[model samples]
Target: MRCLWDCWPMRLTIKSGIAALLLSTGLFGAASAAPAQVADMPPAGEGPRGTSQAVLGAERYDAIGYAVPYDGGANPGAISAAHPTLPIGSFAEVTAIDSGKTILVVIAEQGLATPDRIIALSPGALQLLGRPEAAALGVRVRRVNPLGADQQALRDGRPASARIDAPAVLLAALRKRLPAPPRSVSTAMPRPPRASNAAVNLGAGAGYPVPGRAAAPSVRPATSRQGTGFFVQVAALSNGQRASDLANSLAGSVMAGGGLYRVRLGPFPDQASADRARADAVQRGFGDARIIHE
Candidate 1:
């Protein structure tokens, strides 16, 4: 019953309020919906943001090069070295590939210092490593973090900084490298199963010896820097004494490395002997026993 003109403003105000309410609700819904959708979808790429996928995908660095003798330039008696990859002020383990002798040396210099070589040690350092006259001694340099006290000693250029004693278990391995002995097959036993698809070749151009059986694909014999002959790997245990005990029982050898003690059987003179030993080990409840030809 209200007059149209008197009611027009009121009706317009109500409509405007309703519209404002709808607009606010729509904007709120839109903002909330976008975040929810984003939460459901994982970010793309090899990893999430800030991961810098390149670092995660990069290959591990394996340093293999030569160690050359260097006359002490400014510090003749200092046990120091010039390296290519190791940072200055850091310590490294330089091992002779042929002699298996290992020594710790400080990195006093760096840069393009060693062109093709991995490290250039001082004359004293080289002598300590027992490679004083070696021009291009094949070496593998391993990085190590020295103790704070040792770091101070190394900084002072003390000989003790370079002194290191090989573990008893690793003593034999640290000796001079030798060529592997000849492998002879025993005709007494039937041909054993191949452990791998890859063929094994004896050096001196020797071929497989099975009669009436097709020889396996010929592959080059494996070479070892420290010359570890064929052996059966029994187990890697935490206790070195336990490994020693096992080794004693089986006439095996205990090799300590990588924070574990390895119990191995037979650096047998030949492969046939190792195979027989491996078969025996498998029969003796070592389900994981396998010949380590490498």
Candidate 2:
């Protein structure tokens, strides 16, 4: 037979046999059993020992930067706002960045400001901030007081409570000095039966007399308190007689103060109820009837 090294096939077969023998003897097993290469690893740093625990961007937050008007009209001139996160009855301090004018505002309603805005202020706050056109910008806000659990609980489904309560508290302090509600005001007016066309007898070339609707009783205007709770100021007047006449016509209630009589209907259970009363008062010819807070 040809020599193993001289014959190509025999030479290759002898080499493979020797390699298998070495592997079975465990001579090169250490190399074969070594850990995988970087290419075969999980990732650059994916193992249990490789991960980092530090959080990224933990301090990122949106700061209050501007103010919009709280347009609910319940407490027009009150220092109040609709906040995105603050619970009702919570109080916040607002500072105008440019003017450095700071004021306290109560959380009255839940709302998110525009991405570029922060809180919505009441007319009074807006005016105090010197932003009377319904909106202000470039302001800073900080929480001054958090709502207590009990009051926040009471204001859970009732957002108006905060707006109403602030003014109510102030009103309570001044109640003893305030004038009492007017009594015995008659809002009654004569209501004639509608004249039927048939009763008038339609005749050719004959003009029939048409009676106009009765005029609404006149009343004085009064300024409303800036608080929450539902009421409609149908009329306000310094003239007691006119105020009494209007109150009597509407058959509602009256409050007199500061030489002015206010024909009002309240304290309704909710804003919707008060709004409906406002509409009815307006329809009844109190042209300036509007929703107001007690």
Candidate 3:
């Protein structure tokens, strides 16, 4: 009968074969897990942990690095690329650092096998750059908006113009974050119609006057005080016309002194008489009226 335990040489051969089988299986599983060396970019708007963390090459607007070329889809002449962090539908101009050959490619998807390579371009894109799809080629990628002039340029088979300078881009970004300007207070706004009520009932003489209403035909003339007794001084004003109008209405006098037109009802017998006169002046809308003596 044959022994189940075979000779040492045969046993070693079987052991090696089993080991090789396990190794190949492990390799296949790892390959299947992250196949194509990259995963399709997570759909946009995924939570931070999901997809929308940010761009990988975002540190530099103009990224300079090597690109791995791969076939994107059926169209061999498709202008597309996969950037680890660029927005999926955005456009970029990829240029060969050495040859300076550039081609505008839309970022169709995302994911990069590693951070060492800045981007993964379609074989068609590399072809446009005049580089071999299999070899390493350093590139310069400038981000662009497809809605901008780049879209039309691509359609015309022309290159996109370089964007505004760094200072201009910085200024634009700052402007967007700045607070809105304060609205101007309008000087041309319409004024309220003048008060039609008698100012004697109100306080001050506000705007607008009906012509005949202010004529006081029975008003008394002011008695001149020869630097004696107290007087009820209605107002001290700069405008002669305004002072004169107030004096005429209150049966007072306008005396000009020290750059002011003084309106006063004067020559009262005593302090009590002056006090009564002051109260009358207040009732007639001279709220600032007070007793004064010469």
TM-score on alpha carbons, each prediction: 0.35, 0.31, 0.31
Q: Write the per-residue lDDT of candidate 1 for residues 227-248, one digit (tens) a residue.
A: 4578787764434455556666
Candidate 3 structure quality by residue, lDDT tens digits, 217-240: 222233343356787777654345
**So what's the TM-score on candidate 3?**
0.31
Whole-model Cα lDDT per candidate? Answer: 0.52, 0.47, 0.51
Number of the candidate with higher TM-score, 1 or 3: 1
Residue-wise C-alpha lDDT for candidate 2, range 1-294, written one tens digit per residue: 657476889889999999999889987577879887744222221211111111232322224355655442344566676666655556565655445455556665545424445666666666766666633445545554334442343234222122211133322333233222212111231222322111010112211111112112243343242234787877543344555556656665556432234566766879889888888876877655677655
Model 1 misplaced regions, further than 4 Å:
1-62, 111-116, 161-294
lDDT of 2 at 263: 61
Q: What is the C-alpha RMSD of each candidate to the true structure, in Å?
A: 23.8, 24.4, 33.0
What's model 2's overall lDDT?
A: 0.47
Give the top-scoring candidate (TM-score): 1
Cα RMSD for predicted model 2: 24.4
Reference-based TM-score, model 1: 0.35
